[model samples]
Target chain A: MTTIKVNGEVNIQPNLAEFEFKEVLSSDPSRKAVFLLLNNKTTGKAAILVADKNPFVEDGSVINEWIKDAKLRNLAQNDIYGSYELLMPEKFNAVKSSLIYPATDKHILKYRRREVYMIYETADDYKSITKPSIKESLFNLDWVYNFLDHKAETDRIVFDDPDPNIGFMLAPDLKWNGVDVDNLYLQAIVVRRDIMSVRELTGEHIPLLENVRKQVRRVVKEKYGLNPNQIKMYFHYQPSYPHLHIHVINIKYEAPGAGMTCIFLDEAIDNLKIWPDFYQRATLPFVGKEGDVLLNKFREAKRLNEE
Target chain B: MTTIKVNGEVNIQPNLAEFEFKEVLSSDPSRKAVFLLLNNKTTGKAAILVADKNPFVEDGSVINEWIKDAKLRNLAQNDIYGSYELLMPEKFNAVKSSLIYPATDKHILKYRRREVYMIYETADDYKSITKPSIKESLFNLDWVYNFLDHKAETDRIVFDDPDPNIGFMLAPDLKWNGVDVDNLYLQAIVVRRDIMSVRELTGEHIPLLENVRKQVRRVVKEKYGLNPNQIKMYFHYQPSYPHLHIHVINIKYEAPGAGMTCIFLDEAIDNLKIWPDFYQRATLPFVGKEGDVLLNKFREAKRLNEE
Candidate 1:
């Protein structure tokens, strides 16, 4: 394998992908970077989706047809939960995709999930209910990962369901949902066994989250001792997650991205059921704080014009 | 005023702001650039909300009380609309704001509006009941100014309220709402007399938009021969414009940024009515495509952390 690096100042069009990937590597690194060698996918293309990330263009549009490859990597059981939703040049072959707001079901291949196949198993034989949310077969977060991670752990946990399939851990830490989670009485973040975001959502993954709403409802009503109407279970569009989790908060509480950036799990599920094409047929909205990669993809695609 | 130019490969942190402004100037020119002079607003700060025009940061979170001056410009009536929402350093003092996804009213200074004190009157006085949709006002789409400047000659105008207080221009452009407008239906782009975005929506602007829904309902019913439900009015989060405009489209149409990037006019109106602090109280979520400035502001503010 050859590693190609483009350094120094260069005009955008010819060196666009290399220039962008260098920046992408600096800010985001969940996926490996793809190099443009002589026989590379984007060798002659003026505009190409260099990696499976968002659309990174040299200018207004493209000049050539490009190919992409999976920057493959190996994962341990601990990382089995991460959303490997990286797009490859090959993905477009499976579907008719658009850089402009994913226009059709054919564009569904845009939501690429990293290859995840392992089922993690902890050293100890997993118990049924030491805690409902803790799945013994999942990645264990440590203090080393983040010095402030302990702050989240110290806060009260409303509920924990220990099933590996529907495994989850609950925390009423103010960090998950919004800033006023404690003050406004908004709610907690319900972390799952996996560490991923909504981009990984698909028909196959839909069934995995099947009981999330039901389980959350039952526990909130009986275990947490709260009224069902006031409790709300939702997901932030571009949620900040070390691990993929859900937010269960009170409806009366108003917080960051609450209405705009979030969607009710019930609403998401209903949307899925009504439109069988759900993930593919419907338009999945994402909020990038402004200069984010995903949002840039839309801009480069010309779907969203930046003024 | 001193103009600072940055060129070639250099370590950031040192010449960060100048470096950033160079790139900003390269892509978006609607907003002026601010250099971090020794006594600059970002002199000692790591990250700063330099100036809001969608691009937010120079690098990291901020420090120091920054000062801003308006980069004045000359405007011709022909060059009516354009990106006039860049927040100068001076705007923050007038408003209370937050960076938690545009949460507090503090960040409210970001939505800067150009001083549009004049009303454009077409040569014909904007006759009523001409056409439902016009191609002119949709995206005038000039690299610089808004072409809706020529109101009368090109298309049909249903209503052009001369009062700048209730300043709104209505045109039924099938393009304003969705792609297949002829068969599926009705539309309008309610151009506000002033240059601003939804984030600039204060109580004062509400009165201007008051009769819009009522007027559209009546006209689409009487003139266009369409049901009021078929006539839709909405707002794009990041609309293409020189001034703020409302998208009045049909409900039957399936289009881009439907759920994620749009808010219904009625919903915005109700939200303002129910909560007088409307813009101040709620969190404003933005979709950031790679290299966007405002989204960068959030990242610099630490509201959006890259993991």
Candidate 2:
């Protein structure tokens, strides 16, 4: 819409030329996360403003940022947890958007921010920062495509042919020790068939997990050409993948996150038998490394106190 | 210690004749359910006055219940769901000498009991009510005795013989169908050798659950004289037993709690392989019939919304 002023002074109404659009991304009923993409016209920079809807929208601090891209709909993450990318590049014209009167209708702009996921440093480098999960961001994972793109995730897989029910794969992980280590197969992962990750599991999904030892043994004996007795499986608490996966390793090799960190799948199944929502109900205890943003998220949520 | 007064205005101040004792029941760093056995000299009725340290020592709420024969710690449930047997025999005096207070100091006690477990009803009725597991009332199971008692629980076992790792047995249970059903072996249970129940399990206990299918197959072949595929194993959520047992029933039988209510043992093991605290973490969701004390506890805690 265009408006012209009768006097020499140009009169611009609030909604004039203020275009906006909205889309539901990775939604599943409630949300796993919600975010905003804001481009500054003055500094010529953008930020993937991921947060609980409270901060991103209602709290108005995000509104205070004077971000003009709120109406632009073409921005998306390079991948889950990766920095955002805007498809149509443009120089924003919202420098006056925050200063415009009628208060709530206008944004309060701030430039030069820190501690956020910034992508325009360059296009190719996708730095990942997991979006905080909120009611609006419940992720509806596109598993079929993941199976297509990362399906070669099965490349490191051995022995048994891959089935949608299960996948036995060598993790793109470091060896617990040097190549000189005795047990090379000591670190591998097993993924769930029907669901993406552990968080999605209900008691109903437990059966798919049953008899894990025998199934793994079949894979070990048939696929790896190894003795079934030597293999053991493990699932680390607060695992790295967003998917529900298991690690199968040689019993002889002592790997990191082993022993107590390792929960026998059988025990987990039995526990679920007694309490189906065990994963959801259990207060997870985990250690954070130096640059762990997850720990920061936990600290922000008061789930864990920061040191 | 005894307080003697000659005239009517007797000086029975503070610790004149206060008597007290302590009992250590299921205890950890923060809690131990302690109680006093008191006897009403006039009524000749006894009660197990149970409460926390304060109610037992300083406050006299627990002492007022007047229980008899507390050293007769041999009290047990008429049924696992019923009350303790302290009511059966009723002549008690403070047997233990704590030497703390003067001896039976004062009675600032009133008795109008709205909540308690009572057992005088009968024994043939095996009412099944799970206990509410508050932090103060965590179970301390006695396993060695269950082994001694239920060790022969393995004798009725058919189709499968006991392995050091796995043990199988037929339970003395009624058919799922009323009087019409046959094939009782469809409801057999497999008990783990080491731990009492799922709560005691850690990663180390997992191997005992491994190759369960193979063991089950061996049983189906040898003990049942049937094909391996005919049998299936189920572990009910919030099962009544203190021991870790798996139900190895015929797969064709449509037992109650089968699909979602029951967790397949195999799935349990697999889940544990990922996160060991599966059972401990899962919030148990169950329906309790009226008169079930545990549900009453949940109601008290507001875990489930009131009807």
lDDT of each: 0.36, 0.36
Locate the minimum summed-lDDT window of 10 residues in model 1 chain B: B114-123
By TM-score, the best candidate is 1
Model 1 C-alpha RMSD to native: 23.1
True contacts kept of 1: 0.00
Error of 2 at A42 (Å): 94
Q: What are the models' TM-scores?
A: 0.31, 0.28
Give the per-residue lDDT digits (tens) of candidate 2, residues A25-137: 11110111222223333333332222211101112233223222212121221211111111111111100011112222112122212121101101111112232332224
Q: For each candidate, how many residue pairs have backbone atoms clashing (under 3 Å)?
A: 44, 49
Q: Provide the lDDT at B22 for model 1.
A: 12
Error of 1 at A267 (Å): 15
- In candidate 2, what are the lDDT values of residues B66-128, reduced to their tens digit? 211121112111211111112111211111111111123232122221221111111111122
Write the residue-wise lDDT of candidate 1 on A1-307 in tens digits.
1222324322122211121111111111111112111112243221112221222222211201211122212111121111111222332111111121112233223322221111111111112211122333243455313322334444554555555455555555454442432222423333343434443455555554666766666665565455443455667644554355677764433333332345556545544544334433223343333434434444454444221
| Sliding window of 10 residues with minimal summed lDDT for model 2 chain A | A117-126
Error of 2 at A123 (Å): 34
